[model samples]
Target: MKAIVATELGRGPRGLQYLDVAEPVAGKGEIVVAVRAAGVNFADSLMLAGRYQTRQPLPFSPGLEVAGTVESVGPGVTAFVPGDRVLAIPAFGGYAEKVAVSAERAVAIPADMDFVTAAGFPVAYGTSHLGLWHRARLRAGETLLVLGAAGGVGLTAVELGVLMGARVIAVAKGEAKLAVAKAQGAHHLIDAEVDDLKAAILATGGGVDVIYDPVGGALFEAGLKCANFEARALIIGFASGDVPQIAANRLLVKNVDVLGFWWGAYADKAPAVMADSFRTLIGWWQDGRLKPHVSDTRPLPLAAEALELVLERRSTGKVVITVGD
Candidate 1:
């Protein structure tokens, strides 16, 4: 197997090395997958720097989601067999030619979906879907404001918000990125580089009933000031590198609800919720209501470069790494 191995913490993507490694074997209730594609995420960079909530030991691969073919199945795994095409949330070790994942965490991908799109599907879409429908209880006619609206998870929030019938205001850095958000069905686009975010969001009318914030810092502060009465703000992530400090007074003044969400936690704490989310997401995909935007696809050897694109915010949607044919 060939993998991009992280030699030490805090060394960043530059510390990764693409080299031959021992192939993973399926353990009990696990399946060994010959990876076809892997999704690159901001969490991968955080884990490499030892800053994320979950950390792997030194000298590990950092990839959260992958799409591949099942090469072999372990004992007690009856749902999948060799040659099955599946997508998995491995949490880590997906930037490799092969990965051994528990059967319970893997889902059979639709036959028509490409490996690259399937690789990018689970994390971003899952986070947005669960955050909007389950946690925030977003109403169809409400106004929704999305920060970092052209990035991986942010773009999905824009699309889902529109599908749910909300008037979506997408905030991003530039016109190019804002255009991408608009294509995904954003009703309004605000360039955070030039526009005053609070004013731009308020101009959308009725203020914002729900704020889907993945890029925190100044954007979160602005969103707090612009929130409607009894609004819900979903804290998805802090991609801007500065985690905002929420003022308790703001919540009191507006009767706002700041809801923190982590999609990965549902796998253990509430498996049924996670299962239902995937079912609905796959159904939407089959119906052409959900379109996953994969901005860049690179071969296995350029895995580190793909991660760099995410770290630098150079890619619009999801960046995928192609592992095997």
Candidate 2:
């Protein structure tokens, strides 16, 4: 099997090499998937550079989610059989021809969903779903603000926030990206490059009840300033490369709740929550309520380039790496 191997760290995505590697076999309680496509994420670049929270040993692949056909199931695995089409959260090693993952982490994808869409679904949708629905408890008629609203997880948050009946305000870098968010039902679009984020967000709905911020740093501070009393601010990630230090006075003044949500953590700490979240997400897809957007698809050989698209913020929605025909 051919895989993108990271032999060393701190060199970024350019350090990755597409080379022939040993095929993975199903281990106990795991299943081997012949990968059809893999989702590219910003964290892949972070992991490659040794800046992410989770670090695998050297000489590893960096993809976290994949969609493929089941090649084989390990002993004691009865939930999936060979030839099953499913998506798995492998945590690592998804940038390969085949990956072995625990059966518990794999979910059968809807028959109508393509491998490209399925490949990009789990992390972005799962993160927004769990963070907004479970953590923030976003309610209908309430004002919801999504920062970086045209990016992968940010787009999904815009869509879901609208569906959940909130009046969504989308913040993105340009008109092109803001237009994408508008099509997904954002009631208000703020150009982050031109407008004052705090004033624009406050002008639309007085103040936001919940803020979904995946691009931290200055944007987060601006969102915090425009938050409604007792607003729930969800800290999704730091895509801006700067982590903001929140002042204790701000939280106390507004009685706001700044919640940090790490979707991957649920896979290990609370597997049942992850499973239930996927079930709802798949149902929404089947009902024609969810539209997943894949901006670019590259061959497996260009896995590094796919990662680069995400790291450089050049691509909107999700970028996928196709493995085989």
Candidate 3:
């Protein structure tokens, strides 16, 4: 088996060194996945740089999701068999051609969900759904604002917000990204790089009912200004590298709630919850109501280049690495 080995915690190229390794055997209650595709996420870069909250042992793989068939099942596993198609948000070790994961952690892929697309769904879409549906409790006809709306998690929020019947106001860097968000079901767009985000949201609807902010820098502060009474601002990430400080006075004045979505932390404890969420997302995907956009798919050997593209923020939507040629 081959894996994009991260021998040390640092940035890409300096930390990542691909190498061959002995094939893994599934322990009890685990399954060995013949990974056909792997999802590239922002967290992957953070993990490589040792800057993420969750740190792995030295010399580990960085990918958090994978899609493929079960190559083999462990002794106690009964939910699936060899060759069963599944998508998983594994704790780690997804970058390899094969990975061993607990059977409880895997979800059977829908027949209509493509492997590459499924690889991207569990983390980004799942996180978006959990935040919007569970935490924010976003409702129909409400106004929702999504910052960094062109990235994976951000785009998923746009699509899900539309499915939930919210009038989505998307904020991104440029026209190209705004176009992408509009095509993915966002009702309005804000070019924050040029125009003001808070003013745009205020002009669009006076205020938004919910704000999905994946990049928490200046936008976090900007997001606070465009909240209606009881509005929920979901803090999804610090992708912008700055965790903006919030004044309690503003929260009190606006009577708004600041929510956080740390999807990975709930790992083993939230498998059943996430699985249920996946079922709902699957219906949308099948009915054409929920769509995950894949911007690029590079071969496994080109994984380095794919990371580079994501690091540069040049790629749009989800980037998948096809492990099998």
Candidate 4:
């Protein structure tokens, strides 16, 4: 099989090479998938630079989520068949023609959803849904502020926040990106390049009740200052390359809650919750309520370039690597 192999680390995307590799076979309780498309994430660059939490051995493929057709099923796997279309969450190794994942980690993709959309669905959409609904308990009629609103997970947060009945304030770098957020149903947009986020957020709705931040740094700090009393701030990630040091005084004064969330952890800690969340998301997708924004699509051999698009923040929404026809 052809796969993009990462033979060394600390070299960013340049370390990856498209080369022929041994194919995988389904093991017990697992299924082999003929990958159609793989989702490129910011973490892929982190993993290559050796900054991510999970580290693979010397040689590996770097991808987290993928959508494909089932090629084969191992013993004890009855949930899927050879022709099933599904999305699988392999911890890594999705940048390949085929991958073997535990059946429990895979979900059947909706018949109407294309492989590119399904490839980008799980991590980004799942993160926003879980963070806003489960962690923050965002309510309708409340004000929701989304930082990095043009990015992959950020766009979903903006869309879902509005769908859940909150007035959304989207913060992004420029007008082009802000326009994309507006198309996603954001009620208000803040140009992070010029506007004062704190003032703009406060001006938009006095203060926001729920803050969804995937880009941490100055923006996170600014968003914290504009939080309404007892507001819930969800820390999704530090995409800005700088983690914020929370001020104890700020939390005490506002009685605010800083909720840290990592959607991947739910797959192991609470598989049932993960399953239930997917059921809801899929239903929304089926109804045309959830539209995945894939800004770039690259072929398998150009996997490094695909990762670069995400790392450089040049692409809005999600970037996908098309693995199969």
The most accurate candidate by lDDT is 2
Clashing pairs in 3: none
Please provide, for model 3 over 92-161, each residue's C-alpha lDDT reduced to its tens digit, 9 standing for 90 to 100: 8888899999888788987877889989888889899989998899999899999999998999999889
Instruction: Give the 10-residue window scoring lowest on summed lDDT in candidate 2.
Output: 193-202
Model 2: CA > 4 A from native? none
Off by over 4 Å in 4: none
Regions more than 4 Å wrong, model 3: none
lDDT (Cα) of model 3: 0.86
Score residue 45 of candidate 3 by CA lDDT: 85
In the predicted model 2, the residue pairs found to clash are: none
Tell me the TM-score of each prediction against the true structure.
0.98, 0.98, 0.97, 0.98
lDDT of the candidates, in the order given: 0.92, 0.93, 0.86, 0.92
Candidate 1 residue-wise lDDT, 53-170, digit = tens: 8988877999999999999999999999999999999868999999999888899998999999999999999999999999999999999999999999999999999999999999
Superposed Cα deviation of residue 293, candidate 2 (Å): 0.6
